[model samples]
Target: MKSESIVVVGAGVIGLDVALVLAKRGYGRNTTIIAEHLPGDTSINYTSPWAGANFSAISASDANALRWDKLGYAYLLSLAAKDDKDAFVKESTSTEYWDEMPSPAKIDSMAKYLKNFKEIPAGDLPSGVAYGIEFTTITLNAPMHIRYLLRKLTEEYGVRVVRKRVSDITSGFLSKDTKVVFNCTGNASRDLNGVQDSKCYPTRGQILLAKAPHIQQNVMRHGKDYETYVIPRPYSNGNVILGGFMQKGVSTADTFSYETESILSRTTAMLPSLASSETQILAAFSGLRPSREGGARVSKEVIQVDGTGRQGVLVHNYGAGGTGFQAGYGMAIEAANTVAEELQALA
Candidate 1:
């Protein structure tokens, strides 16, 4: 039988992951990625590169989100265990401090990976922190991980990527034989011709990359009005990522100097090594996360082309917000399953 042809819209984490899963599931050689940007290109519109790219199990109570988080954790853990040099995944100690007691659902979601998990005593907790959790989690160098996935898709799975700005789902597919389409465009789903999800919006995030290899563990501080994080990448002499506010409904990617200072201040309080005289501030980056009023949209839909009256199968896997890297693999698996079901229905 000929390999099934699939057109995957978007080249961010979600799109790349879905394409990879489809190829692994017998869609090899004919799977193609159509996107305006590729893995290495760093743009404000592309959210993957700007991410701290760590798996902290922040899904909390949502059953669907938790399932995807667990799946991604297992998949990434397996990849990190590999001895390959390009595996950009690593294990790290994660400490999350909250001003109030964290929800039980959040605790339950992370219990699966609780090796040495502990709750910080109120006395030992920071001045404002009421509770805290310490556990090991997976973190990835976002750019490196994306490149690794791209290589795996092309070299190993025979998947191909095409650079194009798609206005609609119908025009996104380049392969004439494409029978199915996976709409994985992140924030672009808000304006894409066929999708135009009104609920879709952008959540702006900014991060400061600094040279702080001495910082080994990942730390997150959840305050009443502010949130901050410190993520250290161990490989490639990677820089420590000091992350910042989640400005909801903000679309502009401009980096604010004040926000950068706030990130440094908060992260420095957590890890003094970041303020060390030798530490160098490498760069600052901001990106708009593809957020939706509701949680991520990952389902199958039949979309009709404007010019061509024919209908096509569209497996939507976008609007993951900041959890894109952490949940990409799991969501992609779900998208691929939808594709399989659609193909079976057609057959």
Candidate 2:
């Protein structure tokens, strides 16, 4: 067997997950993460800190996306059930409302683990909603969870995270032992040297976090014009996250006061407890989801190493948009599989 070494670019949820998958595949001792940002950093470029990170069948209609989601959901369930206090994944009742019937395929797939899953009566749903699905799922406190992944990667997998950005993918393929480079650069892929994906752009999102310990579930309203969601973080006396607007073609990460007020208004109306007298505003922020024109790109490509005739594969894994955390592990598994194939061919 070839002595395997891998370099994963970016350190957001997606990057970290990809590295974790690589480690799990027995590359733990040879994985290195190169990124300009890490878990605790707060910036527009880092989307993980600003996510209402939860496990939902958001891509129920897409076969590929759904496969990733189901895999991630099962993995998280295992973590949550294992009694590891720092697992950062917890179960909650989740509800998603739509204006019409969801795809039968989606409903069927969810029924596998969502034993309590059921369609809601139109009368019980919020006004203007035509259908709904309620099921048990998990939510992640992204900041805390990112830190947890960092520790896991280091302590358990021997993966090291380097605080630096790359100008080219070949930089990671420099080592004679490095067989492949995983490009998990998120939106940075739009401008990153050697992987300028013009289709990559930001789908901006904003949310307000408020103190609401009594709220214990996740609720989402899906519509043609607007979408609203309320996710309660059950750990660390964490605040409830109320969101948001999916302003496509927007790149700014500045918080809009009115948007905050609008989210508060909509979420409180959906979950009245959010408007309780004891509720207090904790914070409001914005993030740019790494969205691509076609959807997430999780395939591999071969690139010639700079100044050297040798060639190596560059596995692309960005453009996950808002569901980065939700779809992270699943995508990572895919990336890892790609890496394994490339390594095998090299051998």
- Identify the candidate with maximal lDDT: 2
Off by over 4 Å in 2: 1-4, 344-347
The lDDT per prediction is 0.80, 0.82
lDDT of 2 by residue, 5-85 (tens): 678888999989988887776776777888899988999988888888787655636777778777888788777888335
Q: What's model 2's lDDT at 266? A: 88
- Over 4 Å off, model 1: 1-4, 306-308, 343-347
Residue-level error in angstroms, candidate 1, position 39: 0.8
TM-score of each: 0.94, 0.94
Write candidate 1's Cα lDDT for 207-251 as tens digits: 888887678889998777667898887585857888887888987
All predictions: root-mean-square deviation over Cα?
2.0, 2.0
Q: Which ten residues in a row have the lowest lDDT in candidate 1?
A: 338-347
